[model samples]
Target: MIWPLDGASSDVVFNTWSHFSLSLNLEAASFTRYITPTKVEQKVRHLVIEWIRNEIVRHIPDAEVLVFGSTPVDMYLPSGDIDLVVQSKSLAVEGPPRSNITRIADILRSTDMALGEVRIFASAKIPILKFVSRHGKFSIDISVNVSNGVAAASIIRDFIRDIPGVKPLSLIVKCFLRSRDANEVYRGGLSSYLVVCMVIYFFQTHKGMRKSHTDPSSSLGNLLLEFLQLFGYDFNYLQSGISLRDGGKTFSRSERHWIYRPSQPRLCIEDPQNTQLDAGAGIHDIRRIQMLFIHAYDQLQAEIQRRDRSRSKALLLEGNSLLQIIMGVPLNVSATGPRWIAIDKANARKSSIGSILPCSIPQGDSIDY
Candidate 1:
């Protein structure tokens, strides 16, 4: 478990500025900093990724193991899982042999490998092999082929490096979604991949707005609020779908080759690499999810308004309430002696934190994935 610093000890620069400025600037900075995972967590994930890669190779000499998803993109949360794709060019083309994933799971489960809770989902659409390290520092998902995930990870990493505010803004939106209990797709909510795509699309369309904010952080905060507002109040799920490749421009169902059906998800996000697949397919309740986005928008607006009034007491409550509602308690990692906590099945919200990898894409846009 990672323990974050308490308010008294946190590196917040509030006292130096005027009350209003402090409340607006420092609070925003603190919220972002508090949610961003520490470097140690990143290091542990990297080590776990390497170990999973080696274990897969040790078992299948010809197998190719490639790390993808958030681990590669560097946007993973403290509770995130590592995503690995196992492929042998020959096996990848023909698809998994009936027992392929099982054998790999067995190899990784051997006592020498020091991995635990090895489970193989052979019947899954992608056929995943899931395992947690014996130390419980991290969990990983292994799949066959699925190079598309790797390709998407590469695209995200490049965006982080090339784009000014992509990383922080994406991270902020993701944390917001996670806080609202809307980030897990398997639970019929938004996927982290979809959230990222949404953030990227916003950035693409709102590049002009970046000039309005003085710094990257403020721009990110503003963009995040706008993102929530857009999805919550303005986006028309029934009438349109989001296309990141097309600069986040909306496409009509007919023009984009999307057939509207009652059974399909309310929102349609074209996969960046595979346009045929809908990344937001798991979103079963559009109204409920949009309500969450709106709720967050309301909370953020309240906090900003309190800051404007210079009501420190009210501001603190609203700020903390917003953070608590969104991110659970700020994990006191320093106090939690363990470097990593085992995935708790009881905590349904955080259990699937790192499970979804952003690889699926929607149609349109200038830059081809």
Candidate 2:
């Protein structure tokens, strides 16, 4: 429970930011603990990877299956997709051959490893086979001969190691956007990688935060508040673009030759590895996203003020905590452990894949690579 039941209040006074900060810190820590994969879950992931590898190899002996993305970097949310890259001498850099993708899809469909339909997006810029695991515990995206995801994973790992507040902050932001249904790149929202880069940029560019020696863990509340403030109202998305290269800097969009599409108004996050690519290009509703951030910041501030006023009167106010007001409900971990709600289950789109036969790949369905 993120907050006490209605009509309940703490026995102690809550008149300062410290009290609210403490609550935020506790909630962040609790959420992190609940979302971090347990040893058993890790083992299951590994087993699934190995099973896929073995299945692929049985047909294409030279193919290599490699885990990438958040899974490799220990930054994944509970329901996050596992990204796998299949490398083979025969596969093209653009993507795997259609025949190969179809073959792999067939293999996956024949086995019980895949829970629902094995969807092969052969026409996608980077063709992929997407499916849910048989246990319904994981969603997996497999791309062939595409090394970019693997490379991006390595970069994220470096950021996690070198940056002070990358891990926890990223986790929190991921959950925040996910709860709002704005974390999927295919759905005009931000991807997990884009979310991470935004956090890294926040850490690198904020002078007060950069110069402070405060332990990130102890100051998560303040950091999160400031982060919302920065992105919500301060960032000039029309002129400024986020970049992680050269230790992080915000470049002028015009100077970078990145056009500002007023109609779409997407966040511009330059790909550190690929200078020409805009990591946030997929997002079509940047204004709405920023408005969401602003609302979260305002709601948190209001909660703090309300609590302070209530405490001044020696009244115990019962309601959602600061974090809960913004992030909605705290995830409920089932007693059975692995089965848990990664976000608010009521609003989340349930995976359609579930012990069903392979659906025909849509030739016209495609997404940016």
lDDT of 1 by residue, 144-218 (tens): 766788898877776667566777777666665665666777776776677778877777777565445456665
TM-score of each: 0.77, 0.82
TM-score of 1: 0.77
Off by over 4 Å in 2: 1-18, 92-96, 260-264, 312-320, 330-369
User: Each candidate: what lDDT?
Assistant: 0.61, 0.71
lDDT of 1: 0.61
lDDT for model 2, please.
0.71
Cα lDDT tens digits, model 2, 111-205, are 88888789999898877889988753578888777788888888888888988689889888887887788888777667888888999999998
Model 2 residue 309 CA deviation in Å: 1.8
